[model samples]
Target: MKIKSYLLIILIVISAVGLSVCSYIYTPAKYQEYSVGVDKEPVMAPMLKGASAGVFPWSPVEKQEDPQSLAKKDKVAETKPEAKIEVVEPKSFTKVDDSYFDDAVFIGDSRMVGLSQYCPEIDSRATFFAKKSLTIYNLQKDAWIDVENGPKETIFDALSKISFSKVYIMVGINEIGRGTNEGYRDAYADVIKRILEIQPDALIFINSTMHVTKEKSDGDELYNNGNINVRNAALFDLIDNQHIFYLNVNDMLDDGEGNLDESLSGDGVHLKGSCYEPWHQYLLFNGVVD
Candidate 1:
């Protein structure tokens, strides 16, 4: 009985061992799939650290950059330096004043008398051949200015006595109503020619007649702007724009409506000495230098 029981136990143990081996070998492929849940990571290739593959024709470089560099990268912007701009100033002409008219002579009627009486700027440096009613027709014969400790000589005689560098003549206010434009122009030319004959080196500045006051111009037909403009236009014939220049003093004293500023004149004809500063300034700026 003991021998038979032992034999049965031995057979059962042998069948169990055989069945375990067969179960592992005969499992179908359908049931032999990879356990994705158990093995979370994918199969990995061997690492080729610091190794280079040949660059492709379209690629810029051969070696791969760092893995961190290849990721969705935060680009660091390159800052450029700023360029500075420089400003340049333009060049212009040098203005000439004061010393230019030092040796000048002014010849006129009441206007010139006003300047000599009022303007110390004119009196200090210049000589004036002027009288209250001095006209172009009578300037050479009748006009006489007081000289320093000398006899009052005629206008033509005074010019001959001294050789001046500049001769500034302003005439025609007294003569504008006296004669035709042709007669006035002829008389003016005669005065200019005589001055040139006496002082050939003199620069003759023919100043235009200053405009009368608006009241005088509008009231007196003879002293109107029409007559003055006609006379002013006629004076340009005497200018060569060389040594002879036409300086329009009317512009200096005008009220901008083609009439003299009422404030500048005591009479409608002559400017007060103190008020003629702008006239002196105009000459200082516009007159020629040596």
Candidate 2:
């Protein structure tokens, strides 16, 4: 009888073990799909305690460091020039608190419209107008000067309507393609001068011309890789005033391949609504907005 009881107990233990194995093998997966749960706290990647990614990508590594060498490095870092960042605090724009300027004005070609749509909140502070392929020459086509409207409108048009405290301009990609570097520079400089003359106190923010793919840029014979270099050079040449700030929002917009991302622009010229958010963030970072 005792032997029979032992055999029954052994059978029961074996059955239990077999059943557990079968259940695990046949059960459906707890989670079939992979997802990142927003409710859970984000897990940051572990970083090294002391060292960081160095600035120079191809720098030669040092074999060893002594106390004197470490001291030398500290001294070198202290003497190294700090990065020159173009950060303009919003206070500069808000300082006057003028009743006439509760509204801001943005004027340019088609690019301005996309920028406006991407930044609707900014529209609350100002009215934005972007006439497609419109230029000062078009506005005054009948005039004796015979200026065939260029890529953008004159700064005077934006200034004439309101005592604007802030004016943002992004133009010249169209005109730059058609004209010589010198011509583009002169034309842009004239536009800037006109804006300052009309509203001496208004802050002016000049946005850098964005890059486009080589395929689209190839359409115009007058425009080439050299055009971007010339236009940027001209833009920087005129930055002598404190109030007239320049923001190179292009650096962030580029896809790191020396060309604009096709996803950012609808027609290789005008940016999509999705593209503007990052551009806006870049503007804020650079102090273009207060």
Candidate 3:
């Protein structure tokens, strides 16, 4: 009986040792430590049979995210879309014709008046707003640009009532007698601003002041090329080389040495009827268009 009792006791001890070894090999603590060491989002682990046996309990384990996926997401967050910009193009013209002036208007001094008288047929295509010896200062005065047996109106008042697509201006010969080149330009610029205000879309052609006969320029200092060129330079600056144009009609009528051809003029100042044809032809070839 004593030997049998000893054997049973040894058998119970061996059984206890085997159960401890199995529990240590498959513990919940081991799996928990492995999940904690990884860098990732956490998730619940699947139930195990050992939990039903009361040997161990399973819980949540952290899952590691792919490095490449994280990197791609970060790159997308940093990128931005670019802004779009708009560009505008300016108009230019190398040549045109007389029909181009059908809706045009001319405003100026005696030279412009002479244009209507010498070339009435050509002048008929465009309306003339001109007078003898017209200056910027006197343009707004009453009765500057008048009509036949009708109530006279100021140039500004008359211009306010009308509009034109093309506005040609040549009125500085009288103005040169009074002010400096800068002063003349300021007055001219003011005139241009008002004209633009009234006729916003008009294609402006600022004709160069015609040079005098060589003998006439030699006779008077103020009426010479020295003063005329100075005034014309002011007009040139007003042109943007796009919207406004500086037409040198003198190219057709000038003697090539900065002097008006003596034969073209009877008074060394005004061009004769015969010479106006070339001036009209020059306008036909050089007029602006888009």
User: Pick by TM-score: which candidate is best?
Assistant: 3
> Model 2: which ten-residue window has the lowest total lDDT?
42-51
- For model 1, the superposed segments whose C-alpha errors exceed 4 Å read 1-95, 143-152
- Candidate 3: worst-modelled 10 consecutive residues by lDDT: 38-47
Please, what is the TM-score per model?
Answer: 0.63, 0.55, 0.67
Q: Best-fitting candidate, measured by lDDT?
A: 3
Q: Write the per-residue lDDT of candidate 1 for residues 1-290, one digit (tens) a residue.
A: 99999999999878755543332332222112322321442221001110123222233433446677755343422334456787543222135566655778998888878777877866778887777778888874564667788887678888887779888887778887798888888888888888888888888888888888999988998988779999889877787765677777777779979898999888887787679897877676666544
Error of 2 at 143 (Å): 9.6
lDDT score for candidate 3 against the true structure: 0.74
lDDT of 2 by residue, 56-103 (tens): 223343456679999999999999999999976434322232232245
RMSD of 3: 13.8
